[model samples]
Target: MRRLLSAVAMLILLTSACGEDTLAAGTYDGPLAAEGRQGAAHRVVECDDAPTGGNNYPGEYDNGALSDEPEAALRTAFDEAQITGVHDGYVLVREDDDRALFTFTDAGRVRQALIVHDGEAFGKEGWYVESWARCDYAELPAAVAERAGVEIWFDADGPVSTRRVHSADGPEHCGWQHLTFLSLGETTYVRDADTEYAEWTDAPYDSEADLPPHAVDTGFHRDGDHLWRSPDGTRAYVGNREKVAVWPRTKDGFTCA
Candidate 1:
């Protein structure tokens, strides 16, 4: 919990891995793809406005059924420096971290956690948006806002339905490449048994590959190598990490089995 990065940066991330065609064959335009499809994660967002989800916390499976399954849709994608460097001209800058922490238990469904900084004018970028659970925090798409290149404020549509995610810090569960969290719904996946990936071309690159299902699954959990549940296990994406990324129920989207 306090090792952050070492061993020669984990041997330069196992001699560098996570090759999705070197960050998904880049391309973006028009207001940075309209802030990569409506950018957000939080900006003084405070919602307890009272939706009051049913009090059946006991195996609470009535109607919502893992909250409109699809592995529990929640999405955001972008990488290649905020889609070709700050909307093509660079003016991007995200700031907000008053000690980032936005949990969900009163029916927010484990969402929004920040530590942002996606700058511009000349150059600036930094990230840390752990658990960006989204039900639709205002639009969101554009490759799920560049997979965490940085700059977000989506609240995931107020009161999250099933599962959602947003964590950053690749390399160390298998060095490099891993930042697409929307565990179950609206397409957000990457967990072929804790992703020991070394290949999967059509984007995301460096070299070596073999794990591609794209997005969607509804049940997964593993704990020793930290690959938490909630794609449809009811909230708990990527526990303590040893290998985490989900979407494995049996059937869903992202095209895997």
Candidate 2:
């Protein structure tokens, strides 16, 4: 499944360059890519089924009141399960009598979906995480999106606007190479991905000088991050306020030759 998802992501990355020009350019049909090294990071673990050491709150509450204060309810539920690191910036995506979906970006700029459901567990009625996952640039699954009542824009290739900096050297460990930087407003998402490893970093700069010393130039001239590119576009000298970083493009995903 991992290999298949990687292959699918590659195919999407290849064909998504067409954008809206192609028939299926703007659609995405796949489960939320499980994050983390274990590949089970997104699995939903019921709080009641597991031992919460008395963290699980077993009580009766008004459904309408709980729905009105979703965040508060979720906080109580998360506390019951000892779930931490989720707070603020909660956008209610979907809410029904049985369940509600909220989306938020953590401090690392990784988007996450939190599902709180109203059901009876251990003879108590409350809200708890049905499931949650790290959603970087991919769209939510069809069923999830449908419940959210929003149209998610999915490009087969990847993010619509991004600057890709190919590693000067070929695959390092586990065929990891390219660095894709996506800037959305004030937030910049730096993603490192390959056949095996995938990681994201939030590196937002206030100005050119604020950018890190080794920051790769994404060819956005207006942003003051300039790159002196070779005539063939294989080599580049990325300039910043203090120093310049150089990268020689690789060919065939392995060699600089």
Candidate 3:
């Protein structure tokens, strides 16, 4: 009995250690924010319909041979460009001599597809952001999609739910403002606008107590300088606010319509 208990304890310890290792291995410590010029807009289209080359999707001036390891080469390009917030969870979906396709979940839990083209046909080399969708994995070449599927994991500290409120009209739309609320675990982070926006602020808090209360009500209240939904999260009262934004909860997450 003693030997059996010891073996069971050892197995449990090994399982715990393996779980921690896997989590740590998948953690990404790179810049969580985008830098430099923004890439092409995300769109749903056939892989063959993806843009080839232009100012928006510039090609590198490389006269040498293409790198044998396309995945590593693409990682180098992504790091050099300081692209969007792709923090770990990378799966190589397809690869060949001239092109490689990868899928990764961004910090916002938005699945994105990336393609690295050798540019042999166009005499240049470059990487492109193929597609990004909120819930589903963006469309890909049928074969690649079959292999990649839609499996993705979010970091413990990554955004699990997102809610947004935007100003519909302003002084020539000049004073237009947007607020995004990202819920990550027990904490909620608020941003003034999307990460790509020029001016923005990021604030994180644990609970309503952390925010300065602007007003209080039985069901609705204003905390953290932003209006919040009721405890049930069904209704919100925005006094004198121009627009009321309500996002329905979906099986995957919050859907903003």
lDDT of 1 by residue, 1-257 (tens): 11122212221111113222212211112121112111333322233321211111112212211112111111111221111111111111221321122222112232222222222211322222222223232222333335434223224243232234333333344444443333343434343323333233112221222223332232332223233344244322343332333333322433332
TM-score of each: 0.19, 0.27, 0.30
TM-score (C-alpha) between model 1 and the true structure: 0.19
| Candidate 1 global lDDT | 0.26
Least accurate 10 contiguous residues by lDDT in model 2 = 48-57
Q: Which candidate tops TM-score?
A: 3
Enumerate clash totals for all models, in the order shown: 47, 3, 0
Candidate 3 TM-score, C-alpha based: 0.30
- Candidate number with greatest lDDT: 2
Q: Order the candidates by TM-score, highest first — what do you get? A: 3, 2, 1
Q: Rank order by lDDT, top first?
A: 2, 3, 1
lDDT, each prediction: 0.26, 0.35, 0.31
